[model samples]
Target: MLGPNGAGKSSIYHSIIGLVKPTFGKIIIDGIDVTNIPTHQRCTKFGISWVPQYGGSWSDLTVYDNLVAIAELHIKSKEERLAKVNNLIRKFELQNVVNLKSKFLSGGQVRKLTLAMSMVKNTKILILDEPFAALDPQSVRMIQQIIVSLQMFEKISVSISDHSSRDLLSCVDNAMVLSEGKIVAKGTPPRSDKKY
Candidate 1:
């Protein structure tokens, strides 16, 4: 999804994830009607995971501990939790900063950690809001690469919302433009010479 501020892009994501209910329509996922389902059930049973625009993390906890905490929530076995955390650490290249508190991480590291935490439970649908916000150019490139890799290799359905559409169009197969709580356009990305 791409839209300027106040375009209700985040609301669309919130509605899809069950945080906001639709008054006039049904919310379905994987062929199931999830409109009335509780948020926790929607996440656990429907494999939906969300990463907010500001990023979600236990700021006081170490990077390693943050990953372990999320893994332990859904994974009961101690060995499994350790394995999952370790794998994410490696995949996100957090080995050197594993012991550092999450508050100390750079913008790119924080984004990586948040993404890894969201996928700890093998979520089928991942929603990220304003992922490139507040990121430096280098961090934006790094995060973009990671998102592409996850979509291709992990086969996860990823939905991303950004204020600007240019950077996101190249990576997405489909996109919708929202304005004033309505979808103004829905289609594949336009070529470089065309403007939204």
Candidate 2:
């Protein structure tokens, strides 16, 4: 579902997570219609998670604290929650900055942290907008590797939008292009159209 700026990708994400009600059409996950379900209820049932372009985490909180809170909220067992949060911190290479305030993180770090938080509950479906925005080349490559691993190992369904064709091609098997809030083309996107 990735596209260029102002392509309504965020809008679509919000609608799916129930933050913004759809003006039309149905949102179905796992063969169940959830268009009218409340956001919290949907979180519990469908394991749907979203990381918006401009929102996530408590800025004043340390990276570790923020993830701890998210893990507590989503995971039932105290031990399991702590284990998962620690695993993600290591997986995303956040140990160096785990105690730093989220506001102090570089854009790439924040994006990685946000992605980690979105997977706290092992969500089956994830919608991420601009997941690699403001990342350096190395950070981008690291995130790409994590995403590819998630796809192959977890079989999680992810819809991510990026301006770089390499980002999408590195992780996605399919692409859908949108214009003015409507789908214009649906097919395999190549590595050449990086801006789409």
Identify the runs in model 1 with alpha carbons over 4 angstroms from their true place.
Answer: 190-196
Cα-based lDDT at residue 38, candidate 1: 88
lDDT values, one for every candidate: 0.84, 0.82
Give the number of colliding residue pairs in candidate 1.
Answer: 0
TM-score of each: 0.86, 0.90
* Among all candidates shown, the one with the greatest TM-score: 2
lDDT of 2 at 149: 68
Residue 91 CA error for candidate 2 (Å)?
A: 1.1
RMSD of each: 3.1, 2.9
- Candidate 1 per-residue lDDT, tens place, 38-94, comes to 899988897889998775999999999999888878899999899889988887778
Candidate 2 per-residue lDDT, tens place, 51-75, comes to 8897598999999999999998878
Model 2 lDDT-worst window of ten: 187-196
- Model 2 residue 25 distance off true place after TM-score fit, in angstroms: 1.9
Clashes of each: 0, 1
